[model samples]
Structure formats: structure tokens, C-alpha cells
Target: MDRLSRFARRIFALGAGSSMALVFLVIFVNSVRRYTIGKSIAWGEELPIYLTIYGVMFGIAYAYMTDSHIRFAVFLDMLEEKIKRFVLIACDLLTAATGVTLIFAGHAFAMRRGSVASSGLKSTGDWLAQITGIPWLEWVGKVGTWQYAIVLGGAMLAIAAILRLSERLSAPSKAKEPVAPLAAPAGKAST
Candidate 1:
């Protein structure tokens, strides 16, 4: 399990890094073209927007895997150990539930958009279809942008939540160690 978690983290990091690099390169080239050639790539902005979506989706997973997501630690620190553990477990359960809800909602939204795109593609003239040589209806029918971003983010969050819950459950509880009394200083009378 530990090995699998490590491998997953590495894959997420690589994906996020690649997406970020692609976004940066696309924006840089587009800017150069606009300034030097006086014309920019038509689809340049679109590609970067998609890449940013992918990068942010993967980044969420990476943050969860690294335990870098923000939390109110001060409140947890003030709680008793057992109470803290209970609160953590509850939070993990809530996170998992939210992730599952997002996955379902994202899937539904993607399917609806795909259906709309497919219908629009089917209504286009043959000449346009022949010029593009794209199976637009079929392609749009199969994939949606939401699948790449929201669905992926939700799936990662769910996995992270489950892993956290398991780790918390398996960990051995630690008892507070007794503290020793401070001794009198050398050559000084005891209080």
C-alpha cells in the first residue's frame, strides 16, 4: 500500500508538472507571435485554458497526497488526543462524501455537454465536416472537459480521504508522558 501510494504521488506530480509546462509554453509562444509577427495562433488561448484546468485538477490531488492542504490546526491542537482523532475521522468521512458527490455531478454535467456538442456537430454541413476531417459528433459524444478536471479532482480527493481514514484508524494511540519536577539550582535553597 505504501509503495502504491508513493507511485500514485509521483504520477500525479508528473501530470501536474507537464500540464503547467504546456500552459506556460503556449502562452509564451502566443505572446511572442502577437508582438513579433503581429498575429497570434487562433487556438493558443484555448489550449492554455484547458491545460490550466488539467494542472489545477492534478494539483489538488498532489496537495492532498502531500498533506499540504490548509486546515485549522490550532483548534485540533487544543483538543484531547481521542477527541482530536474523532474529529479527524469525521472530517475524512465528510471529505469522502463531498468527493463522491462531485464525481457524480461532474459526470452528469459532462454527459449533458457532450450530448449538446454532438447534436450541434450533426447539424453542420458535409463540406465543413470534410474540410475538418474530424468525427466531431462521435468525438464530442465520448469526452467532455468536465471529465478531465472536475471528475479527476473528485476522484483524487476521494482516494486521499480514504487513505487518511485508514491511516488514522490503524495508528496506535499514544499516552501523554509524565513530566518530572524541576530541581533546585546548584547552591540555591529549594522553594
Candidate 2:
């Protein structure tokens, strides 16, 4: 079980890291081309867009493992120990349900549209479509559309992590902010 968990974490980190790196590279290349060449690179925009989407989508699993997502820790920190556990369990269950629902929705939507025609992709190019050979990229052919589904799967896994870890955790410390707020004037009501 421990080995499996470690492997999963490694996979999550790799996916997120690759996606972010790709996104950055694409953007950087586009910027260089745009200014140096004095014209937009026709396909440059889509690479970053898709990479960002994939990176963000796949990063959830790792983020959950590290408990990095936004949380209501201010409130959780104030609760009694017993009450905190109850709230954490409730939160975990809610996350799991939410992840499952998203996966279902994504899959259903993908399947319904699978057979429908997709116009040629711009910017990033439908590399997925090209892989199997489709349109003009006869050499590449049509690509698989299963990747987005995988992203949804990762999110569900993240939720699973949350569920598994909830019972074992102490309430997390609140994150500190560098800039303290200035006090409002005594007579004026604060917004």
C-alpha cells in the first residue's frame, strides 16, 4: 500500500511538472517568435492553452497529497479537536463526490461528441487527432481523445487522497500573510 501510494505521488508530480514545463516553453517560444520575427506564430497560442489546461487538471492529485488547495483553515483551526475531525470527514466526502461528478460529466461529454466532426484545431493543433491520422496530417492521422478523461481520473484520485488522509490529520496551520491590514478609522464602518 505504501509503495503504491508513493508511485501514485510520483506519477502525479511528473505529469504536473511536464505539463507546466511544456506550457512555459511554448509561451517562451511564442514570445521570441512574435517579437523577433515581427509576426504571430500561427500555431503558438494553442500549445500553451492546452498545456495549461492539462497541467492544472493533472496537478490536482499532487496538490491534494500535499494538502495544498485552498481550505477553510481559519474556521477549522478554531474548532475543538473532535469537531474538527467531523468537519474534515465531511469535507473529504464532499470532495470525493465532487470529483466523481466531474469525471462522469467529462466522460459523458467526450463520448457524446466523439463521433461528431471536429474542425481542424488551430494554434496547438489537435495532436491527439493527428496521432491516429485525420485531416491533413495523414502522416500523423487521428489522435486519441482519452487524455482529457485521464485528467478527470486524476482529480478523482486527488479526492480519494483527501478521503484517506482526513482521519489521520491534525488541523492544518493557517497560512501566514506578509502584509497586515491597516486599521480603519474609529468612526467609519469597515466594509
| Model 1: how far residue 184 lies from native, Å | 7.2
Highest-scoring model, TM-score = 1
lDDT by residue (tens digit), candidate 2, 1-191: 45565666777788789989987887788899889988755546644665666677767777766567788899988997778777776776776777777777776676665443323233224564466456554211112243354436646564556645643464463444579798899999899
Whole-model lDDT per candidate: 0.74, 0.62
Give candidate 2 regions above 4 Å deviation.
Answer: 38-41, 115-163, 166-191
Which predicted model would earn the best lDDT? 1
Q: Kindly list the per-residue Cα lDDT of model 1 for residues 62-170, writing each as its tens digit.
A: 7777777788989888998889889988988998888888789888878777444332223333335566886552442233742447888788878877777777788
